[model samples]
Target: MKPLDPRLLRRARGARVFLAASVLIGVASGVLIVVQAVLLAHGITGVVLRGSGVSGVALGLALVVAGRALLVWAQEVVAQRAAAAVKSTLRRQVLEHSLKLGPVWLSGERSSALTTLLTKGLDDLDPYFARYLPQLVLASTVPAGVIGWMATGDLIAAGTVLVTLPLIPIFMALIGWATQARSRRRQHALAVLAHHFADVVGGLTTLKLFGRAKAQESAVRRVTDQHRAASMGSLRLAFLSSFALELLASISVALVAVGVGLRLVDGKLGLETALMVLILAPEAYLPLRQVGLQFHASADGVAASEEVFRVLETPLPMRGDRTDVPDLRVSPLQLYDVTVRYTGRDEPALDGFDLELRPGEVVALTGPSGAGKSTALAVLLGFVEPERGVVVAGGSAADEFDPIEWRRQFAWVPQRPGLRLGSIADNVRLGRPTASDDEVRLALLTAGAGELALDKPVGEQGQLLSGGQQRRVALARALLTNAPVLLLDEPTAGLDPDAEAAVISGLRATGRTVLMVAHRPALIAAADRTVSVGARELVNA
Candidate 1:
């Protein structure tokens, strides 16, 4: 388990108020417990011993029972509210920060890990947040109170409690090291399971067609068995830790009990004082021990959350060089000698590349696979940065421009476009959320998107549509944006010849500056010019 990621717990101002209420719950619970203990010791020594009225005895018992019950219930309610605040705010923060990280961040990490952090890891935090949490403060403060009160009875008893308490934390810390390692390993195995399971399910159709799915049964079983083993290992460690802590606590309480009884027998302490020591001893260690146990659970969430924070913290390479793409006085884009190199690789993708795109000209970049075609497109879209050169537009540096505000000037449709779960209209509206219905229809027509499928459900990742239809939906989204520049990567690869022709025709008529990666000969011929990139030489296609 890892230390808590401070950012995960820091959230909306109101969450602090919820934390305050959780603290109040702990304080109230402690006081109520102390009162209930006194009432029991008093009631057991009863009205006969005190020579008191029956009404006084009955009323005292009623107040003790009702107050304890009410205080426990109130504490639970407040703890639950605090847990809700932590979960809700952390989730919101993850999503909002994710948008800033851009596609590069998503590309590197497993989607399943992100899903786990957002769902399962955060879910596991509930117990610590609600129950064992406030005691983090109470455990320290209440123990001192417990010892102080015990000193009044017999100073030696207070000394015993104080001296033994440090041993609990010492043992806990030593065990915590092994527990943290096991928890990290367990979390990693879980992430692998989630990622593999997602991949297997997503590609189930392919596996079935190849008749290799049956062979995969053993593989899946192995992964599942690994997950189970890791889970059991974590559980075993947790249970052992809990047992050990409880055993130590029981010993401490028993020692206190024996000491108090001896003092009482010797007449050095009264019956009430001896009983108080018996009652308060557990209350003191209970919070501290519970906190140590919960530390295991909270540590997993903290580890996962820190990973999320790491992704959200990476910076984008470069941005658009201008405030506005189409200014009255200057061109939208100006690509100076640009160079881009991937980390841990010596080969540069775009070595001294150059391009100057205007408002209405369509440019085509055609090349064999891995010949820097996609890298060029990535540079234009501000997804990757050139290592040694500057990209200037409208007399401004690309680094200074805001990618969020400037990326709005274009739309992108990858060859394998994916649709989110929603209606066709909902998917298209993502391009231009404020777009009118009529505008969506026009963009659909311009992108060769079918009119009939406009209102139909696309299903998850646009499974309901043919490959061509999915591409068109993405194109329709781009069209709706009315961006000055459009990027279409392998737009016609999986289409029938007619569908390919239609896709090309729609691109030619879009009347916006396009920088597309083309494989179709028709699209290449239709372009005003094409750049061919290969080892022999770079030339016009």
Candidate 2:
């Protein structure tokens, strides 16, 4: 996938202040560099020991150095703020966009890749923001400032430096183009490696049980080894390119040093003028070199972030009205000729399946694997859109409705329980951030999991809880939400008899519209209506 573009960041709404501050820092950094150079050339090299007293030069150098230090500090501080702002703005957009795209887009993409984009990929932008960005600004401002000053002191020196300046960017652009391709591949490899390793580690116990642990280990090793080789290949190219650019910069600066020395010996130039040429030439080239090096450093970030930008640019699969949509607590939901098809699949999962669900009704969709039970719910949740039809909720077409408002009426619990590393109370609060202690406890009790509250931490992904307990905790969150609609898929698949009975009772007492994909006999037996899906159609209740 193409990473998010940096150009989009330039258009971020809340970025004006940070952008302006970064610009100001760049200006200040440029001014300070010039002032410090002039102070060194005139204050110490020319007027200090030659004839003039220590008072003027001493005071000037001190002020100039102080200003330079402060400017550097200010530039760094502004860059950090800008980087953070950029990260948060982009990240929020990604998350919001993902909600709209849902499983339609995500089913084909790797979760590890998405996770990398939000975490490690975003973190990589910090250096670009803090170091390279200020330099990008200084690269423009400092060079022009030096050139203008050069026109006043020595046009020949200015002309020479300007002549070599274009060469740096040209070489940099060439390397950058090549590096861009490599960076993209390298990033892809890293994502693949991360996905493979995460899967292998999580399934190690299962692999051992199946007597395939050695094979799995070998597979992961091959993936990681390939990733390492790809990374080193990219690193080698970037290093060679940087080395070539640095050698060129060194040559340019050395030429200036020689010219200034000869000109001074011939007395064609004064001590201060020669010193200024010596200082300004390198300072001017330094920014250019800095730009080139910074570009090198930002290559990986550019490659990684380009994909993020693309995600932000992708139009959401389901678009909603900017305003709120009415709740359908009292009306029926209708699906008209809806065919749920995975993108790139020749055959649709649910072909022209038509159904209607009324208020206070609990419908269960049952069929063999891949019969589109879960896909149907995914479409209703506004996570995926149908390829051929519409989902009407309570007399309103879902396409034209506000997705966020419509989803606000739901208390969704997916088949798997995804709990973070937190307490039992923390798990339920995700459904409703404002839930009080008593409210959370009540919701847990309602789901038959109140005993878990205030006693232990729900380990990573709630590994501490049995499968049944995990499902109940997730159910508690759904209950706490108290939405008008409830959608679940294979919720009690692994639960014992007692736990399954508790869940079935809770489902019956929900007293609202419900749609679930069930395989459990208890759940199906308890459902108000059961709809069986066949080869390519749904058999109505």
Candidate 3:
């Protein structure tokens, strides 16, 4: 992204407002700076050349200095607030758009990377908004105003500033390119380290069981060393750039000072006018120098925001505006000639896959692993769009109904359920947040989890519960939804025979249109009919 990316203004309303306010503040600051310099120059001339009394000029000088300080404080306040607002807006948009993209797309992304981007990555933008951007605005406004004011006093100083000012930005651009590259490298290193650490933590138990936990020490050390090296490299470049900008600005200002001093020695210029020109010379170069320095601080943030924009710009699947979906209790659901090919896969996940689901019947999809049984469920749930076919519901295409509204018709139980850190009752209530305690208990009983207490705590991802217990809680949550259709993937896999029997009995009792992926003979036997998938043609048994 550029120093001032227009996409930011388009994506974040706060950025546009901040920009406008910064412009106004920058102009006001410039006016104050010029007035302060004029007063100081006059006071110095009177004291040294005319030997005039200091009473009048002293009060005005004090007021102008205080006003300038107040303006600086105001800029700080506005910049901080704007940074907070923009970060909040960007975070919300990224999260919302990720959900809209659905699980299939997210499956390909690293959760750790996304987490780091949302947290530490976006937080880096604070310096960009709070320091770099304000300086950038000042660089544009203050230089021109200072130069123009100087011109009215001494054209020689003004012309000298005009010729030297462009050099700062020119050097800034060249150095900025290198700084941005370093920043990007550092950011990438940080993300890689974060992803590796998360993976190690998540699978630490398995690693220890295999006696490979110790082996990861070297790997982690390697990644950490890489990140440290990148960070140091970026810091070195920042220091060098700051030094270079300071040197350039000092030389530029010294040139103006030299000429004014020489002319004053020759009696070619008034002392007051010479002092004013000299005082304002450094002011012209100050903003640009600060911009160069702050740019390094904001570089990481710029790189992070570019990644955020890429995600926000990704296109979502086509969904209709229609909210009036037909009732799943009576409507027939059908997938006609649907084909889905995932990236980097030679074979399509689903090819010419056709299926029909009738109302109030338990239909089992039995297929070998990698046969796209879960993919079929995803298609029906509107989580994946078929590349070459359409889903029909009650004689209307599925895409014709809004995806959110359409998903409301079915309760889904994936192979691995996501449970939060909460009580069993809290997790169950997720299916229907307003469900009463009794309703939750009943659902748990029906799903063969009646032995578990409602207030029992489940740690993150239900780690506190046994595998079978976690499955039952997920089943209970799905059962509590009271939707017209049930989509289950290996719902009975982790259950004991008795528990499986209880769950199958519950499904029969509910009489909802059920479609489940089943590998167990018991699950297949429980279905009213079974369809054998992955064959040249689907076979009904």
Candidate 4:
């Protein structure tokens, strides 16, 4: 990726404004640099050549110092805002894209990797935008301004600067190329380490039970050691590059200083001009030197964004955007020869599958494993597209309805609810954020979780809850939505007999259109119609 990727400014709204501000700040800093250099040089000349008291220019010097300090503070503030804006924008974009990709796409990816990318990967971009990017702008504007000013005073010193200034960038490019590969390697190693650590920690209990915890410890140690070594290698290269840039800047300033000294000795240059040229010479190289230092700090962030962009660029599957459709609550839905085949799989998940769901009817999809029960559910939820046929809702094609609006009609409860770390009420209120405590309590009672308190904490993925409690809480969340249609997958698979009977009874009493994948006899018995998927036909049971 380029140091300042144009795509970031184009996609992130606040970043464009931040860049413009950075350029303006750079110009102001440059002007101050020139003003301060000239004033300091004049004061020195007065004291050395005219034997004047320090009081003559002390106030002017103080004012200039104050102005420079103010500019530095403003620049820092703007840089921090820019970094925050860019990170927030990118994080949002990545998450939205992931959601759009649907559950099928996510199934192939590791949860830990996705989590790390969204959190730590995006966070590392802070230094790049906050520090390196501002220096990049300053590197361009400040040196040019300093050189232009020096030219008016002494052409020879200015000409010397012009000659040696190019060498700093030349060396920068060469060293940057050498360090880039190493930086990328280090970033990859760090990502691997993070992914492995998250995976191990997430399943630590399972590892302990299986007596593989000791073996996993050795694996973790190996990856950690590899990351450490890679980090050291990257730092060594970064230090060398910094050294090269600093050495080049120092040499350039020395050449300019030598030219000014010789001119002053020959009486062609005044003391003030010689002193000003010397003072401004190092300032000309300062921005570029700083850019080199900051570039290394932001390398990991840049590498992480490369993956972000890749995901963002992936094509989304076609879905209808039209919002006009009859009320799904009373609408009859029918699948006409729907077929779905996932990538990298030889057999079709759903082939020529057909089914109809009527309002207020409970339909159960029962089939062997991999017989397209879940795939059919995905089709109804607008998460998967069928290649061969169409789904009709209310005598109109499903494709004619807006995907987002269509999804709003259904309350879905998956086999695993994918609960976050929060209170039980928090999970229930997720689908209906503004739902009152009374409404939540009623929904919990309806879903047979009246015993669980709303304020009770559910640890990550509802670790604090038993299987029955987790399912009931998920059902409560679904009930909170009060959508016209209910789609559930294995809603009673893991529950005890009593809990399972209660769930089936609650589902039957809802009087809403219910579509579920179920293997349990009790759940199938509650359904108005049971359809088999494995026989390439719906066998009514």
Candidate 5:
């Protein structure tokens, strides 16, 4: 995990503006530090050493204090804005890149871990930008400003501050490096815990059926304990580091105070000059101490950003020029020697698979479990890319056209439908948002699901409906799209004889080119032609 990668600032224009504003605010705050310190010394000397009245300089001191307060408030505002811009930009970029990588890439990782990274992990970066970064700027500018002002009044006190200042950063660097390591460990622990919890919850029913639920309890507890220990270790290091920095700042300020007092007592320094040196000495160390404290607070965010940068740096998949494909309804859809191999697998999921679907014909793909039936559908839907072949519709290769526009011409229904919590009509509307009420009802009738009312509410994941009814609703959605091609992956799976008959009948009447994967004899019988996929070739079934 690198800290504050330059690519982050360069990629997000809004983040650059936020950082620029923070630096500008830090400069203004440094100017205020000098003015406020000098005015306070002047006012104190007038009443004590010069024997002048306090009322003369009272208004000037009050104005300077007010100006300092205003600057502090403005700095916080700028810091917050900068943090928001960076977080939002990073989140959007991560999501967009993940989408472009496609589901095959995402399915390899835990969904829970991805959720945690996008939500809480990126959110942790807030403190880094809003507090730690601004303090770092102040630490660089304010200390220099304060030390330079003191040198003009008392060179001895200025030299003492300059010498002791290096010690604070030296100690900070050693502690910060250790803390960063601990913070990274804690972040990793958190992601692992989240993934374990999510997996356990999703598989709880299976575990109970196997009488292994109790066994999972120990696994969960072990992970929870590890996360707790990591968190405690990070907190302990933060507290220890903060204490060390405070102690160093206090001792350095004390030395400057002692030296100034001796010089004034010896009559070598004027009362006003000694007072100014004493005031400016603490000011020089305050920014440095504050930066050390804030660094501890932002360690977790910095560690989390390391993962964010890793995801952002992932290379995107190659894409071709966006050209419109010719209409598929007038010509045939053909796969010529297509082959696909998944990551971390010895054999290709698809190997030299070839087939053709003519207009108005139903084609059924059949074979053993790993016969690449689903992979063929994926190739047509533009989800998976083949390493050694082309998918052609009409005359042009599908890869030459924009995948999104090409996919829009086809309707797809997976083996399992993902339904949201909504009314039946609302869920179907997702297929074609501009569909009218009559179109929705007609589509439902076309898919043999007209019995389900439009306004009927389906609970989460369509739990209210039977499995066959849910399949029908998914079919209705496919019909509602009014696409020229229909791609179904095991459409009649888990259906009773009556429900399966209704689905097969509806699919035959779709009046669109159909490409489906099926293992059942009844589904194969309904297709105009059946193509059986093997390890390396396609055979007529």
Candidate 6:
């Protein structure tokens, strides 16, 4: 990202306001700085060079100082608010765009990395907004104003500043190039550590079962150490860059002071003018030095913002603006010669796939594991756009209906249902939040989960329930929906014969149109008809 990425101002409203305010503050600060220096030089020259009282300059000096302090405080307040609003806006955009990209895109991404980016990663931007950016505005305004003021009094001092001012930024650019690389590496390390830790925790149970949990200690330690090293490396470089900037600025200020003092000694310049020039020289270099120092602090945030922008800029799949979807109960859902080819795969996931889902019929999609059974369901759910062909409903193309509205017509249960930390009733209520307790019980009973307690707590990802029980809960949730179509992805994959039979019974009881990805013989037998999905030629069983 550049010093001030225009994307931020375009995407976040707060940034535009912040920039305008910063400019005003920067200009005011510059004027106050020059005024303060002039007042101090006048007071000193009056008291030292001549018999004069302190009363004249005292009040004006105090007011100038107070005004400068107020500007600093105001800048701080504005920067903090801008940081918060920008982060909030970016986070919301990322989430909304992720949804538009759909599950297929997300399935290929690392959820842990994304979680870290949204949480810890973006938080690193606090320094960028609060300190670095405000200083950047000052750097642009204060130095120019200071030099221009000095020029009116002493051209030599102003010329020296003009000659050396570029050095600080030149050095900054060189060091910043290196710092940016390190910051990016540190950010990557943090993401990798987060991803690794989430994976370990997610698979901790299996690791313990295999007596390999203890063995993972070394791996975790290694990743943690890498993150630590990267962090320390970034900090060390930041310190070195700060030291270098300070050294360069100090040298530049000293040069101006030496020239001013020599000219004053020769009686070639007045004491008051010499003192004012001397004071303003350091002031000119101060903002530039601060910019160089704060750049290091904000590097991580700049790197993270790049990642956020990448996600925000991703093109959403083309969806229809129309909301008038055909009634599923009357109009058949048809996928005619639909072909879906995922990235990096030579063969299409589903090629020349044709299926028609009529009203109130349970159709089973059965084929080998890699045969795109789930992909077919994904297409129906509007999660994946077919590379070729279109899904037609009531003589209107599926793309003609708004994606969200089209999805609302179907109740979908993935192979692994995502259940949050809640009771069984709470999870089921997600399908229909306004459902009464009796309706919940009826749905659970129909899905063969009547034996399970409604108040039973399901841990994160439904860990508290067994695989079969989780599937039943998911099915019950689906059963509670008012959607006309129920799309189940192997709803009874791990169930015993009795449990499978109960699920089949539940399907028969629900009069909704059904499409299921089935592998087991029992589920296929239960379906009204089975269609094999792998081959180009559709085989009905």
Which candidate leads in lDDT? Answer: 6
C-alpha TM-score for every candidate? 0.89, 0.85, 0.96, 0.88, 0.89, 0.97
Candidates 1 and 6 compared by lDDT, better number = 6
Choose 1 or 4, whichever is better by TM-score.
1
RMSD of each: 3.1, 3.8, 1.6, 3.2, 2.9, 1.4
Clash counts for the predictions, in order: 1, 9, 0, 0, 0, 0
lDDT of 1 by residue, 1-541 (tens): 3333355446445346756776665666666667666766665555536755556656876886787678667767776776777777778877876766555456667888789878887777677666555657567566777777667766887888898888888887778798777877877888888888898889899999999788888888888899899888978888898889889988998888898888889998877667767887888788778877777666666556566566556665645454554441236676667787877779887777766666676667787787777777767667787786776667776667677766776688876777899888899999989988888888788777756456799888888887878888898898888777888888777778777777778877877878789987877877776766444243554
For candidate 5, give the lDDT.
Answer: 0.84
Query: Model 2: per-residue lDDT, tens digit, 216-248?
Result: 867988988988988898879977987998999
lDDT of 3 by residue, 15-34 (tens): 99989999998999999889
Order the numbered candidates by lDDT, best leading.
Answer: 6, 3, 4, 5, 2, 1
Question: Which has the better lDDT: candidate 5, or candidate 6?
Answer: 6
lDDT of 6 by residue, 1-541 (tens): 3788899899999999999999999999999999999999999999998979988799999899899999999999999999999999999999999998887888877999899999988898899999999999999999999999999999999999999999998998899889889998999999999999999999999999999999999999999999999999999999998999999999999999999999999998999999999889989999989998899889999999988988888776678889999989777999999999998999999989989888998999988998999999989878888899889999999887889899889999999988989999999999999999999999999998899888999999999999999999999999898789999999998899998999899899888899999989999988887888977554555
lDDT values, one for every candidate? 0.74, 0.78, 0.91, 0.85, 0.84, 0.92
- Model 1, position 451: C-alpha lDDT score: 64
- Comparing candidate 1 with candidate 2, which one achieves the higher lDDT? 2
Q: Between the candidate structures 2 and 5, which one is better when assessed by lDDT? A: 5
Candidate 6: lDDT of 364? 94
Tell me how far candidate 3 lies from the true structure as C-alpha RMSD in angstroms: 1.6
Worst 10 residues of 3 by lDDT: 532-541
Instruction: Candidate 4: list runs displaced more than 4 Å.
Output: 47-54, 177-184, 262-270, 341-349, 386-388, 422-426, 429-457, 521-535
Q: Between prediction 1 and prediction 5, which has the larger lDDT?
A: 5
What C-alpha lDDT does candidate 3 achieve relative to the native structure? 0.91
